[model samples]
Target: MTQPGSTPSRPRRGAGCLQSLLVLAVILGLGYGASKVFGDKDSSSSSASSSPSSASDGKGGSWEVGDCGGPDPENKPDGYRAFDCDDSGATFEALEIKSASILPNAIQCPAGTDLIIQVSRVFGSGDNKKGGGIPTNTVCGRNLTGEHPGDAGAGGGQLVKGDCITSTAKEVACASAGSDAFKVLDLVKEKEQCPAATTEPMELMMAMGRPYDVICGGKV
Candidate 1:
């Protein structure tokens, strides 16, 4: 059974619209195990109160909900870069941004979120700097144009358990139960946890240097 607070099992359709920005990992040595974002207003311990926008040079200057983008290759403090949905470089779509600590579970992400990343914002002069460190936040995203394991193809869709895919690399209803359809057996942090019959292991990458989330699937 799907966990009560976990992402919904239904596969999310791919979007081709150009979307917003994402996480750029800044290793904070504060021992709080968090990543840092630039130009944030929250205190060191809380989540973001607003969505992330690029304060630097990148596509579409500022980010908003439903925008597509990811970590900037330049790796600046405001390292996230926005991208047009049709651009192959656009990897993720920002679904939710909140003032919260980085967590590994799906709760931080929206129901259809396929990726999770955390970022921090440092308090500047006159800004609240409680706890004496940078403020961190969780950025929930959906996989749109990036690559994943199992050769699921670009913008294949969400890889939740019980989801099904066809040989043509299209997501389908598991209830259809066609002989050629592949059924998602489970989603695990490691490939070793997949059942012996599992044929394909799709690796979903996360931000903030977290481990990959693997989706195990096989013939129906």
Candidate 2:
């Protein structure tokens, strides 16, 4: 018999094996916790590294002044990819970058801008496929020296507020005093007609130039 509090007989083989298994389990648990903590940090670092510094350079960022892009052949506003002013497909050039919350009624461009491009409804994709309208209007500008990218140049750009005529070459001849021409109608259905009071109506054309199925009226 063993003496009081004296060492007992050696444990059986199965008992020893059980003790060893418990020690291994504790070690694995600690390792998993440490990995989780470090793994999260690594993931965060990777995300920050891939992000672009400015919206002007980022793939999904808002456009900046002087940026250029356009819609597809179908007249649908694409991703508005930025392109050089001389690029073949580039249609609209950004003149101002307004906050999404505050949009102005008239085209307010910086001095030296010769033309103005107004975007009323910009399309969206993915979950926003149904709608992706900007909070305010996006205005683009160009000089009158060269040809505009899209065919909708007729009646586009800055115009006189009064009566006007648009030509296929994207030139607007206005009879008004002021040199500002904003679109009165946009994106109408095919074959749709202008209002009765409209003295001069311009047909919308393809590309970013003019809205579809619509007409623009002005005074000379």
Candidate 3:
């Protein structure tokens, strides 16, 4: 028989140290298994939540025909799109809903092809893409800023580097001055990219977030 709350084991008058060591090893093994299970759950949930969500009315972001959309980003209703991305005391202008990707920096694909794009249009994520509380371009497109030489327009940490994320219609916006908004008429693939579109599929999930409303050709 064994003492209460104790495992049955061969009794050795002078083996306390050895038994204690074996008990410790068993405890450690059990802890290791528990930690592995818990760690896996955490990793999976974080991976899923961090992944971008599917654009409603569409998944991945191919704006369907008749889908409520703006005009070709190049051509804005008032003229060209404009916005002051941050109050960083930097005086520069650009269009909204454009993912901060301008021509030359934007990915160019053949017209009338099916494309899935990403949008920084997620609101309540704190008006920025670093997944923290930073502004959009400041967070995502600084590398591509015209003011900076050798720009690659990379910011918005919410997105993996070099992934496709926004879209625009190639319509020409009459050049305007001192505005903070514009619109993209049809969906143009948006991403500060290398060459062709991305072959990877971004996962989507329902989020307790809002939409990012910025002007494209006119208004988003």
Candidate 4:
């Protein structure tokens, strides 16, 4: 991820090694802007409990878990509109909800989280009552079709140098010998820098909001 005031680094060229880079495509395709402040602001050392209840965006709109939503082009009071997860217009799937008071600095998402949505006004849970007050909440979710970077472990891993990638753009173990698996020999800054044996010089478009482009795969 691109941190404020920090230069973005390239993916490693070593075998089975990669830097953790969470790709945020929402900003580019869905009009969902990303903030530089992504770290957890919660003071508690323990993890907060999950809330599946409904929450308001202070604009009379409410949402709950298992819901898929995207920004409303009409600029409705909800600011966002819900859609079926199978719908092509759906951007993200809500996975968890937490109190905003716990996150004073930044919104903390779950391990597999790809997006974060914070509501300035909450209801039916936490400090907010049925009438609604100043209490707030944060929603963590995963992008419906965004790429996952680095070794996300059980969550999911994205394509990186030294990884064996499938035609579908999934990162698989290097040991998996198959026609679909292609080993990434190198990661270069430009397409021209790729080795002569390179077959697929896929350019990582604005990964983590990096200033420059990243071309993956080449012959050793």
Candidate 5:
């Protein structure tokens, strides 16, 4: 008879080796499946982080340089809406768009343009409003066509620079001498040189940012 607790024979040792191999195979299979699941999760996270943000993406519906718009309503004081440049009601033309922190002065418009509109207001409703306390002023520009539109007898044509405009009892006068006639010059400011043809320097006030004296010559 065999002694109790003796070392196992070759066949039994072979059985133990088979069981160890099976256990290792199961561990490796489970590890591979877990790796596959975690790898997909990491890839998805990377894709989401790389996506673009909406507000600063420079997409459609955002104002850009050269976009033209006009004030909403017939004579709204506060806001504007985009319109085609050829639209009959269009008034303001955008020359540039910039952040509030870096906005340039209104008088410093690009060469060959003059400031026609300047706006600094908030946009949006309720909680979605942007630029609440922060103020941003943008200067809109237009070509300097000498003719002032809607004037009587202007005929929708350009006017000559330095021409006299008169508020007569009959029809208005252009470039004529009368008690009511006043000369038109490029918008002037106080302390600036008087017009070249000024015969007698007289102080005439026009409304702008503030009432300032523009020296006129040739008539009182």
Candidate 6:
């Protein structure tokens, strides 16, 4: 007997095959969609990082902001020098901790600055001249960058402000450090510090033993 409005099914084998095929198609579609989403995310991230950056200078050198580009004005309370070569005949005053007793190996700025640790040593030429050259470039196994490092500007070093210094505080400190001669005084800052150096308020000024000189002339 034929049932009204009813259709006959194909073989059971065929029905199972059809269902398996349908499941596989759905899986493939979902997989394709998910892959596209993830792929897009990666591409965007790469694009953002590769965008043109002015700081790169298009010449493969990273540009640092606020680089004063020359020596600090002389007579600064704290200034900079670029260590170039060691004469080993320099002289220095011993450094004493009369102003502050900082951490065992910490370099500090006056009030309102964080503490940093940068070390430099002075050398002596001794009366016999055996070891007096304090090459800031290689003073006590450390290189200093003053107006000259490795011959100053002749492939020795790229000096930044405060990279080397000769100051009352520094001179005093160096004198107190028990070094008989002065090498190059590097005014090292905390790595990645900004405004490499700044003029301190006159109130922070201590009496000067020597007058400061201008390393670079301003528009004055």
Global lDDT of each candidate: 0.44, 0.30, 0.19, 0.40, 0.30, 0.17
Write candidate 3's Cα lDDT for 1-220 as tens digits: 1111222221112221211110000000100011111122122111111122211111112111111111113222211111223323222221112222322113222211111122322223222222221112211112112322101112111222221122221111123212332232222222222223333222222122212111113232
Error of 2 at 189 (Å): 34
* Clashes found in each candidate (C-alpha, N, C closer than 3 A): 12, 12, 32, 0, 0, 46
Off by over 4 Å in 1: 1-22, 25-63, 76-79, 83-89, 106-108, 123-133, 146-220
Candidate 2 wrong stretches, greater than 4 Å = 1-59, 73-80, 84-86, 100-106, 110-127, 133-137, 143-156, 159-220
- By lDDT rank, best first, the candidates go 1, 4, 2, 5, 3, 6
**Model 4: ten consecutive residues of lowest lDDT:** 15-24
The positional error of residue 72 in candidate 6, measured at the CA in angstroms, is: 36
* Top-scoring candidate (lDDT): 1
lDDT tens digits by residue: candidate 4, 16-76: 1100111111211111111112332122211122222333333444445655655544433
What stretches of model 4 exceed 4 Å from their correct place?
1-62, 76-79, 102-106, 121-135, 149-220
TM-scores of all models?
Answer: 0.34, 0.31, 0.16, 0.34, 0.36, 0.12
- Per-residue CA lDDT of model 6 for 100-194, tens digit only, reads 12121121221111111111222232232221211111111111222212121121121112222122212112222332312222222222222
- The lDDT, on a scale of 0 to 1, for candidate 3 is 0.19
In candidate 4, the residue pairs with backbone N, CA or C atoms under 3 Å apart (3 or more residues apart, or in different chains) clash, namely: none
Clashes of 3: 32
| Colliding residue pairs in candidate 5 | none
Residue 19, model 1: lDDT of 23
Query: Model 2: which ten-residue window has the lowest total lDDT?
Result: 22-31
Per residue, candidate 5 scores C-alpha lDDT tens digits across 1-220 of 1111121111111111111110000000000010111122122110111111111111113334555554445223433445555565455345544333322211233222222233333334443322132233343333222333222223111112243443311112343356765554432344356666655343432322322233243442
TM-score of 4: 0.34
**Best-fitting candidate, scored by TM-score:** 5
